[model samples]
Target chain A: MYKKILLATDGSKHSIRSAEHAIYLADSFDSVIELVYVVGGEKSKEDVLHSVDKYEVKREREEKLRPIQEQLENAGLQYNSHLLHGEPGPTIVKFANENAFDLVVVGSRGLNNLQTMILGSVSHKVAKRVSCPVLIVK
Target chain B: MKLQNLKQDWFGNIKGDILSGIVVALALIPEAIAFSIIAGVDPMVGLYASFSIAVIIAFVGGRPGMISGATGAMALLMVTLVADYGLQYLFAATILTGVIQILFGVFKLASVMKFVPRSVMVGFVNALAILIFTSQLQHFEGEGWIMYGLVALTLAIIYILPKFTKAVPSTLVAIIVVTAIAIFGNIGVRTVGDLGELSQQLPVFLIPSIPFNLETLMIIFPYSLALAIVGLLESLLTANIVDDMTDTESNKNKESRGQGIANVVTGFFGGMAGCAMIGQSVINVKSGGRGRLSALVAGTFLMFLIMVLGGVVAQIPMAALAGVMIMVSISTFDWSSLRNLHKLPKTDAAVMLITVITVVATHDLSKGVLAGVLISAIFFAAKISKVKVNEIVALEGKKKVYKVHGQIFFASVNDLLDKFNFNDKVKEVEIDLSNSHLWDDSAIGALDKIEMKFEQNGIKVTYSGLNEESKHLKKRIGGLSKASGH
Candidate 1:
């Protein structure tokens, strides 16, 4: 019954594993996967006024998603890639809820400070906050 | 040093700075007097220091718009000196403190402030808040409910006045109205005049009267060291906060030297030493101050009030000032930290609590921060010590890959070394470090131990996917690991 799937990655090994699980789920459900990598720098007004270099961040995101894209293409999975910008946790939740994604597939735990603060483990925030089912893969 | 920055920093926001300066000047009056009492000096001494420091720092300070004045944190450091060596020696110490601070600036010690952790800063803030609140209690001694009622009234005015208009400072209004009530209502409360007499004259320059000997130098040096450190810490932290608020950069080294010069000048002018006040600086900024003229105006206005309008300022009730300072303590405190204590990691919470308790118990700001940093470091070391090294064997036990995870240092090198049992049926081992980082010589030593142990067992140990830093550190440590060949 799933039409759209959101896959969130932060370039960690765990996130890459989560992308693998997302690709598998998209294949079974016949859903188009939306691969998203958000650059988390806009946490406050000060952060917005002095944001991190978006150009460099976009390039880094593409590099991180390369292997995942190759896997999806090999599996004949239809996917749309997105390099979003904002604080990781709130931004991810907002985007998924607004787009009416059928499922959000994320890592069980994130490695970066912003991601850890946003999700903080155990019945993870994405699983708790998102309207759609959140599959937290290890 | 660009002319554009100089003009923009000083005059681009002249009107705002002047208004902010006036508000800061009003706030400084009662605070200077109270801090002077705490420092065991005449009220005018605090005023002189407040004025001189503000004026000099306005022209030469690193922070363009921050308000520097007589502060309780610096005053706390002075109490012991004044009690032991008397005012002359205290003056000598203040000047010495300034000289030392100037040297610190020259040596680029201001950048060292980054080493101070945010937890320590929060702890310091909370401790100062408690100290300020407790210091105000003595003024309430042997008083009736009427004095308390007046304090409550003053607090109401301060809290409420802001909502109606920002044109006038609520603190100034609160002080004026409360003092007017004290005079007309025949309230049995103490005023500034009750604390000490007013001279209302210009500060006369005087050299500190102390013998230029080792004994004198020894006594004053310790006090001077403490003053210089505390003064710079408070000023630099205040500057940082203001920079964040205004989104601007400041010459921190220049600010340090400027505070030194200000204190030296104020010491020569028969005043106690002072530093930047975060509360007043915030008030100045919020009231439209974004330039040097604001600080200059504050100093001139403080002097004008003391010298020309001494009679009126002297009559201002102590209760009103108490209300204003209590508000300052409230604003100065990190209320969010307290609220988020439960959300914080146990280690961070413990550090913040330890800092507050240590500072409160000892009444020493630096000691509390040190205590917090020490405990935080211990906890941090303990946390990183848990990073494990997982070994995965592949290709029918012929190829074994040891995956190192987390940080490697003196504390956790043993953990890395312990993983090489050498009893496994694997003939070759690849130590994959792409997922981890190498930190020090101890880590390099641990790698060598792993290599030797594997060599003894006829298994080839190879490091794979090492980061640049790890590679550099390994090279520096001189062949900590062997090549891929057997």
Candidate 2:
């Protein structure tokens, strides 16, 4: 039985679906979910440049996590949310591996072949690197 | 914990580091030679600087995987120094530049980078690209059609070869193919050898042959200051870029000190001072470099290439180097800046444009950056210098009540005074300053003037909201001219 579930979300539609799967798993097994959101370095750089007020940047990041946190709260599931910095795939992998998560739930990206080859898909990287069972939901 | 961090930073990705290091080393050659020519020194000076700086930085640099080498910005600052006083004086200046950079690191001045607006950063980059592009143009002048044809061929290969295979950097392939064509086809054209002498001899440690006196210090101080500023600016900016690419943070103060050490050693080694190279670092990261080993391999491999293939490298056509440099400039430029200029705030756009124009006009990178920072500061002050005085009409009273808002400083004192109607037939004036903070003596002086004017009109004045600090300041100063009377 999974004791600890790591759920990585970018607040995308695919991630929302993955979060639902995580919620179902946590409900069945009574696993504590560790909800994680990674702020990509590029995005943070853009935030610093665009936001005139520093609080606006913090507000925007929290805004991205509110709905996902609300879903967990409504489910009556025990969970802890974390805000991490770096590229999504590697940071998630590092955190999950360090914390020895029971399983990782991530969303499969919809990028085309060429785009994936160039920019790379974060979920693919996480699946390859993390030392845990990964559930990639579309 | 320390040992683990060292392992992660130094040897975490050995195979990838070595491979990418080779790619970065290959890319470093043309730039090293080109920057040397710009500084009006022998190609060996720049080559040795690149090798020494890279090797030294690998061991001491704050940012792992960031490649440091002879850079165009540093080279441009050295041009007049090398021309006026020759190589010896240039070496002394390089040493001085290193000393200044070390002091900057010790003072933890890297925090000043936060004050630089994003618009200024964009401008600095665009200006650098333009500067590099213009420097390459010198080779194209007075050359025949063969040079143009060779340059075109070089560009084609650099752009097209990666499609077939990326095992080797396209730049290295381009250099090899272009050199082979020029030599085998029996075409006469300018080559790297023509720019300066290249030998298999290694750089040796020696103090520059200059008189140790106050006069010598005076001669090189200006040049050294300029070089120090430009070098640190480029290196720190390049570090930020690499940090973003790798999704990691780097110690900027440590990097500053590392650059100083590298440059100081490079100066003693009969080499020019250098800093982090943006184009080469990008090549390094894109090629999978992720640890300190990559930079180490890059430095060693560059020396190996020069020592083993000195003759062949010397034969590389100037046109090929020109093509490679042109490609670097093009890639270094932020194309989006041009397209989005009209969409940016007018002040921001103007700052960006001015930074680019000043550097292009004066051939001084530091001047352009300084101008940009100054203009942005002015714009910021103008935006915040408004002291709003709004009448509180909702409050039922026969006396006038005005709420003061925004900053009260020298720039806004006139606005603060202008909002009050001095000739109004009011019995009392109540000024509320709870929301506003007084910044300086000028604000207190202005308040005193307003109170005196109201008193002359027989209107009693009352202050409703003087914060503790402002009240202390006002009491200590005792209303400017009224201090003596008190």
Candidate 3:
């Protein structure tokens, strides 16, 4: 039933699992997967400090998405990827809502209640804010 | 198109802007007062400058959500001028600072920010934190146990209350609670009123009471120039930080112009010049500020607080304000820099340390940054000033062929010259530059000297494999022998 699927990945194992779920749904529904990766403020600042060359920072960021891109290409699926900057949860929510994605998929580590209360899980924020149905893979 | 962007900038996130604006306003008070004390001016001067700058910058600034106000860096620059010539001359100097900054924007000097290395930025921020911390120490002099107790209580509320909720800024909570304790409990401590007189009256426009002549310009020009440079540097850097934090781009040239405008207006209002405050901007962003309205609200709310609750603010103990500033200084510092000292390159570490020490010692932020930049440039030049010569014998050791590698610029020309032997026993000397590039007139001069020396030694010198650009430069200088294309 979905024509456009939004998948947010950060190259973690949980996100890899979430990518599989997205691929299966896209295969069945003939959907176009809109892949997104966000660079947070702290992470971006650290990258700038660690890498003296601008191109090195760009290459490092692109390397994070290589595995997912390889997987998407192996499936022979139609997709477009975007690199965005901001807080991960809010950036993804804003993009998905603004672009009117049919569904949103994210991965969660399923932290304990106390930890989530203090640290604020990104998937929790994304699921709550996005207008479309969310698939939170653990 | 313009209207839509303006609407988005001002009204994109109303609830977030209003709430964060109030938070920023609450944080601005102690900072304004402290910076005033540093500059040897009354507390109201800094307050009025903060109010005007924030409100004006909200409208004209290129970066929304960035907070601009009276800052310690700018105040530190004003100390000598205020001490020597009084407040009127300081006001005139502020106006001139604005004009100079506007000219800088017109000339598009913001492009120079790229030359500032990341290490220097880290050092600047750490130095600022140190300065703020040192400024707080003056409040603890000859104080009783009650002052220490109140400060500790303020710190406790600031650090602990945020764990349960962040709906209200913990800094605001700490200030309110501590103020209540100091007033109701009859605790004896130094209040803000004890620092200087604070009137609830609005700032009125007044020309600086000074002669408008060349003598006046001579008096204020140097101070104004220093203030302008420091103010623009701090503001532009803060703009970059905000741009990164919010994942947005800002027009830095426009920000320069906006800062100039704000300072000019603030001067007429009998206030000192100021710039963007990194601590306040970070607080605004973390509190969900995302639009121009946040800064506008911060300015207006500060004025509102002064007018409506001036009496209560006056009764606030200096201990509470010092505690808040200490917290700000702690957060402003880059603690990880210390941890990463071993991981960073030795040159970068040295540059950062030098920048920090220079700033802390001289109380001059711009000079520290400049020193860091100059040192890093020298280090870079030294690193790249290598010109290697590879010698080969093609004619049974009778003819020596030298292959040059690496860039030949002013720094490397001497190294290049030193690599060649004028008394070589060969009949012919061939210098091959296929792998090297000539960058400046110095490289050409070195080539000429090498050829002259070889000729004088009864050896014929010929250059081969000159790239088109270098060949063109050689032809222009007419200094070197012919280069046969290889």
Q: Which candidate is the best by DockQ?
A: 3
Whole-model lDDT per candidate: 0.81, 0.86, 0.87
Q: For all candidates, what are the clash counts?
A: 1, 0, 0
Compose the digit string of candidate 3's lDDT tens values, residues B305-406. Answer: 998988887888998888888897887788889989999899999999999999999887878888999999998899888778998987997899999999
lDDT of each residue in B1-486, candidate 1, tens digit only? 699988987898988898889889988887898788777777888998999999999999999889998998888777777887799998898899899899989999998766666677778878988888887898889988877887898898888776567577787789889989998888767888888777889999999989999999999887788788878888987786666556577888999999999988888998888899888887787677889999999999999988888888788788888888788788777777877789878877788889899988987776787788788888889898777778787998799887878888889886767676787777889988998888887788778877878888888888899999999989887453444321
DockQ of 2: 0.13
As a TM-score, model 2 comes out at: 0.82
Query: If you assessed candidate 2 against the hidden native complex, which CAPRI class would it receive?
Result: incorrect
In angstroms and one decimal each, the interface RMSD of every candidate reads: 11.4, 5.4, 3.7
- Ordered by TM-score, highest first, the candidates read 3, 2, 1
Q: Could you tell me which 10 consecutive residues in candidate 3 chain B have the lowest summed lDDT?
A: B477-486
- Residues B1-486 of candidate 2 have per-residue lDDT tens digits of 989989998899999999999989988988898889888999999999999999999988999999999988888878888998999998898888889888889899877767878788788878988998999888989998898998999998988777567788898899899999989998999898988899987889999999999999999998888888878877887787677667678989999999999989999998998999877877787678989999999999999999999999889999999999898888777777788889999999999999999999988888888999999999998988977888864335557888999888888898888899888767888989998988888888888888888988998888978889988887887466554432
By summed lDDT, the worst window of 10 consecutive residues in model 2 chain B runs over: B477-486
Give model 1's DockQ, 2 decimals.
0.03
The better candidate by DockQ, 1 or 2, is 2
What's the CA RMSD for each of the models? Answer: 12.3, 4.8, 4.4
What local lDDT does model 3 show for residue A96?
96
Q: Give the candidates in order of lDDT, highest first.
A: 3, 2, 1
Number of the top TM-score candidate: 3
